[model samples]
Target: MARAKNVLWIMCDQLRYDYLGCTGHPSLKTPNIDAMAKRGVLFTNAYVQSPICGPSRMSFYTGRYMRSHGSHWNGWPLRVGEPTLGDHLKKIGVRNVLVGKTHMAPDLEGMKMLGIPPESIIGVHVAECGFEPYERDDGLHPTGRPRPKYDEYLRQQGFEATNPWEHWANSGAADDGSLQNGWLLVHADKAARVPDEHSETPYMTRRAMDFISEAETDGTPWCLHLSYIKPHWPYIAPEPYASMYSTADMIPVIRSERERQNPHPVFGAYMDMRYSRNMARDDAREKVIPTYMGLISQIDDQMGVLMKFLEARGLLETTMIVFTSDHGDYLGDHWMGEKDLFHEQSAKIPLIIIDPSREADATRGTRSDALVEAIDLAPTFVDYFGGKVPAHILEGRSLLPLLRGPTPPDWRKVAFSEYDYAMQDVRLKLNQPIERCRLFMVFDGRWKYIHASGFRPMLYDLETDPQEFVDRGDDPDCAGIIARLQAELFDWALHPNDHITTPREKIAAYADNQLQVKGGILIGIWDEAELAAIRDKIDQRAKM
Candidate 1:
């Protein structure tokens, strides 16, 4: 089997694991994604390193924990010196490119401290999360963070506004000529005013195609991060997609009154928030969910288009296609409106990897229940390009073994995720300090444990209560299980993933090298005989 010449890493923002037909969606038909799953390995237990967009993506880019990277929230910059997937792949001749959203804020302070300019090649990579930004749009253009590229594109296409992204692309028009803002749940039923071809998804897909053409012309082996912003917020779709589904197509909302009653203090604070309370209403779900499903269907159609384009260019067979998400949207699940907690609907993401090599054929169409982390993709790409996985830097194991014949002997036993809510209103509602607003989750297939800083831990037995309708955190009967999971969580947290300066293997080689004695800094040398024996031993060891 030949190694893949390129990789097309596709990611949909806020897409859930179980929302696709491949992952058992009850009504939604996603044939394009489902076909990709059939041709690849569908990771059933894939979890993100963080539930939030920025930190989760940073983990995926660097193959390190959010805590290790120190970018704990949105708009927080990834440190300039941190190594990314692009940095690792470029060393082995893979040109890393980006077409859509990364949610990556640049470390301007760090870059300035080192006298690095934002326009230099290294500075550009650092600013864009190590990817060469063919077209980088973080996709959240409310008022302040306007994406100039997409906005200008929209205006060129005749959609004019102060911010066309927010005006036409994300808004719907009523018969009376008033704009229905997609930001409000009441207007989610209206189709977006933007045309299908002019929407963000199609535009980004075209950019990806354009990049592929240029890369092929230049004969550069590329890893394109073709990320889509839809199936995300402003849950309104354009044209046929908007009218595709109704309330009948919607699945029953996965929340319970029991969950709302006296929930964990941290969880309760989140539920009490405006978005959560709004989504908890029946009218809100009825109006917003179908539109959300439509947005997903629209993304699925765009996937079909992108796949066809790849195949027509004779690149499908040579490109290893990966489909996943930064994190999952709650969508009124567990009485939540956004992805900020450790429920399966929030942290568990859909991961499908199509290794185009013949060695992966045996595992094709198989679903792997092995615990997979979002950080694994970086090392997987490095391994696919025949580079050594630098354990001192990359904190994740490669998924190539899982895709090919031999499963790794030391596979991960638990999946981990994190959340930092200092900027959220939930923290203020709880009267918590900024430093104490951290949450960590550890899931070992059946038992899911969440450790909250300065609060009681939350526990759930997925084996017994798969829906997570019951919280066993305060139950005395679950003491032993909680204790074991806590120990495992602490064990994971104690590992020094941030120790990047010295390689462990290098340290191991330095053991008993007698450098102190060789440098004349011996602490306990008593006599000439002892010193002579030590010198002789050092010589023998060096020769061996």
Candidate 2:
């Protein structure tokens, strides 16, 4: 089978693993994504290295754990000189470009310390999460620094407001001539004021389609990271999508009294936060959840539009379509509103890879329960292009083998995730230092363990308590299991690609050659014929 000539990586923000029909969402319609899964391999238990947007995406883009990249939270910079998917793909002659948000912060300090001028090409690439930005839009314009590109586009369309992102794109109009900002609970059911075509999701999809159309003119293998910022916050959709889902269609919240009562101190802190506590109310959830589902449905419809465009252009056959999200949204699940916990609702995400190569035919329409990580994407893309996996630099194993229908015998058994909430006000109230405000989670399909810095560890026997209502960390009988999971976590924490002074090839080049020195034992002989050949050369040299 031939290698995939191009890659189309589509990432959605804050989408949960079970939200799609393919992943067993009861009512949410995601036919396009579900069909993509049927045409490829879907990983049922994929997890992110971190449950936050920026850090999780950094892991996926760099093929390294969050610790390796050091971009621990939103607005944090991925330190300069770190290798990303774009960097790895470029080595094999693939042009990786971005069409949308990366949620990246440039390492200004690292650039200054390294003497890299911000105006330089390398510096520009570093600032854009290592991608050559075709059309970059992080889509959080109103909250963060202003993005003039999107704002200008909206103005040209005659939205004509001080902050179009807030007034038009994210908010809706009430009958009484009042404005609904979408963030407030009172406006949760309101439709977005912007037209469907001008909304962030469809606009990005159109731009992605344009990128594909342009890339086709040049026959070079290109990977376009088409990221969409939707179904995230300001969860209002345009027109029909806004009215598609009612509160009746919203899935029941996955929480229990046992979970809210006597929770672990760290978990309890999250539960007490306004984000969690506000959503705990049934009224707040009913008002917001329908809009959330509406945004997801809108995304799914746009996906259909994009896929049809790809098929029409004949690019679908040659392009590998990879779909995933940065992390899951709690939406009142486990008594939490946003991600940053070890529960499946927050850490687990949907991963579908549709390799157009005939080699993947056998695995098509099948699902694998193998523990997959978001970081595996970079190595998978590299391997898809027939490039060698740089194991020393990229800490993830390639999924090409699994995509071709056979799970490698050495696939990972444990999945890992992490969170650091020290910067939050809740941490200050908890009196935990920034250094001690972290948590690490390890799950082996059945049993899950969470280790919080400066707090008691928590355990959930998933086989018995899948909803995670029980904390068995202090159970005397579970001591052995706790120790085993702790050891696994310790082993994972030990190996990070921090030191990059030497490549793995240079270190391995000396491994066996060191023993072949002048006074070393003769070890190259395979059989008598080879030994005799060597002896003949030695004898001739002795005579000389």
Candidate 3:
């Protein structure tokens, strides 16, 4: 089998694994992705470093954890010097093209619509990620009605939720409305269709497809990325898919109190917060599941149409199509409705690779339970494109060997995922609970160790308690377990967050973007220098 010169990386925002039929949801009809999974390989236990959008994507491109990449929240772009798959691909003769949103906003405040700031780092992130011919969607709502005016929606509801931006997204406006959703989902029928002026996904998808078609004959293998924003937020799918799945057929609540043992305080506290909102504990899962599954079903429909175009021109076999998501959505899990926090529902993502050039043994529908992280995706793409792994010493290993079958004895037996949701994510959003944002999780294949930055730790035996409803990180009886996992967690904690640095330290590089760490600092465009001076002042305080 020869190498695959063409690659298609298809990404959806906030898509959970269980919500897809290819990943084992019988009720969800994802024939294209499922069929792609059948012919390719499926990683059943894939997780993202962060449970949010920008950070998850940053890890994918940089092969570093959120804290390491300094992208702990929604809006931060990679420091200019950060390495990216696109950067690596270009070295091996693959021209990189980007389509759709890469939520690498410059600061957390940029996520006002999603508990973020007023500004974002989209341009900087795209530049740092190293992909050329960049196109992005407007970070506002998708409706010609001007995204239903989130601020206005909040005002209408008499919501005094502080941040007007955050309050709107959290309003019923976020959900895909149907009778089952009650008031939880905003009924916005006029929200459908991506307008030619502001529609990024549809326009970018067509542009990406055109690139794929043109690249096929150029004799230069290319990596074309088509990122869709649907199935993410404001969960309004078009007709048909919008009404595809009914709540009756949706999978009901899956909490097993009988399976509960010890749970983390922070995790418990997080759920309670959601319940404090409008999220209910009773059958809330059933109501949300259909809408979530329907969103996925809609994404699948678009993908199916794309595949048809590729196959129509006889480009399917020669190209390797990789299907995945930036992160998973909670979809009302644990009385929660969004990403963040350290539960499986929020951290898990789907990774499927279909390499048409692989031998039959590697091409079948076999599933591997191996733990893979979103960061590893870069190396896998680089390896497939016949490119060199830049000398960055990335945190994630390539999946090429795993795809070859039988893991090597010396290979790291466990997969690792980390989240710093409490610290940076909190500070980014002003007035966030300063003390509560201290949770950290380290998951091996079997056991998971969670160490809250400033609180008691937690441990869970994922084998016996797969749901992770129980915590043993501080259990006196499990001292040995805590001691062992802590060693790794501690090393990871103190490790330098940067992976790909620049030749000119002053000119930090991102994928297609760049940052300046010249003064040994990188700050937001506004107040960056002022913040630096403030940090210097704070550093003197530490000395005092």
Best by TM-score: 1
What lDDT score belongs to each candidate, Candidate 1 first?
0.89, 0.86, 0.63
Q: What tens digits encode model 3's per-residue C-alpha lDDT throughout 388-450? A: 665354677777777767655676555556565554423344343654565566777778877
Query: Could you arrange the candidates by lDDT from highest to lowest?
Result: 1, 2, 3
1 or 2: which has the higher TM-score?
A: 1
Clashing pairs in 2: none
**How high is each candidate's TM-score?**
0.96, 0.93, 0.74
Ranking by TM-score: 1, 2, 3
In model 3, which regions exceed 4 Å deviation? 1-4, 106-128, 138-204, 256-263, 274-276, 281-287, 422-438, 494-544
- Candidate 2 residue lDDT tens string, 7-71: 99999899888888899888898898889999999998899999998889999999999878888
Worst 10 residues of 2 by lDDT: 509-518
Q: How many backbone clashes does candidate 3 have?
A: 37
Please list the residue runs of candidate 1 whose C-alpha ends up more than 4 Å from where it truly belongs after superposition. Answer: 1-4, 515-544
